[model samples]
Target: MISKDEVKHIAALARIGLDEKEIEKFSTDLSSILDWIEQLKEADIENVEPISHITGMENITREDKAEDFENKDGIKKMFPEEKDGYDKVKSVL
Candidate 1:
């Protein structure tokens, strides 16, 4: 099990304050997590294929096509507001 001093040292490194009760609780929790990790060390994954992700999804992308827009007047008419010959939307930040 993790000791009180180890817990305190970890909390100090993380820049978090923990009282005596919290320190004791986290000590147990951290020890349990470490023990679980130790148990996982015995897992059988010799033949398992290494992968970056589990989801079988492919990225869909299109080639960038930059062209001169000739519909400036039409776009200006669709927008609620316009500024400097461009559509003005709400500030994202």
Candidate 2:
């Protein structure tokens, strides 16, 4: 069984604000997940081969290469705001 304090700690780490009811609910849910994992530990795997993925799909990613932008002026025209010949964006931080 998972404790309420353990649930609170996990919630804090995840930056989630869980009320008393939610905390209680997750305490039971997390305990069930741990119990299921415990059951998985009892499985017999004497000759099982370790595999990275179940799907036998190969990597289809293309090589990363910097391509020259052909539409340099198009971006400036599309941008709503500009400052001193440079693109002006709102402060992210």
Candidate 3:
């Protein structure tokens, strides 16, 4: 079972501020979660096969193919400010 002090410690570590009510509630909730996990540990699944995904889906990605832009010069002309061959913007730092 999770104690109130343990819950408070967890809240502090996570940088979450919890009131008295919240601390009490979390203590019970955390204990219940641990109990549920313990119950699951007793289940037998020796014959079960591990699966990556429930829905079988294959990678449908297209091959990477580099192609030159048709209107490269035209697009460059649309930029507000251009220095050499690249766009010039305000300093960020």
Candidate 4:
């Protein structure tokens, strides 16, 4: 069983704030998840072959072709703000 302290430590590492109720709920949830994983570990799969993907689809790729940009000035003019040949947007941080 997962302890409340372990859940609190995990929340601290993830930098998320959880109340007392949430911490207790997550402790049970995480304990159940760990139990399920342990059951999966006990499964016998020695004869099973490892598969990368269930869908039998091969890698489909197109030939890389360079296309000339005919409307460079027109595209640049569409931007609301441009500075030093680059688009200037608001700072995210």
lDDT of 2 by residue, 1-93 (tens): 999999999999999999999999999999999988898778898999878987978887987999999988898887789887688999989
In order, what lDDT does every prediction score? 0.91, 0.91, 0.94, 0.93
Write the number of the candidate with greater lDDT, choosing between 2 and 3: 3
Clashing pairs in 3: none
Question: Per-residue CA lDDT of candidate 3, range 1-93, in tens?
Answer: 999999999999999999999999999999999998898777898998979997888796987999999999999998899999798999989
The lDDT of model 3 is 0.94
Deviating ranges (above 4 Å) for candidate 4: 44-93
Best-to-worst TM-score order: 2, 4, 1, 3
How big is the positional error of residue 29 in model 3, measured in Å on the Cα after superposition? 0.9
Candidate 4 minimal-lDDT segment of 10 residues: 34-43
lDDT against true structure, model 1: 0.91
Per-prediction TM-score to the true structure, in the order listed: 0.46, 0.51, 0.45, 0.46
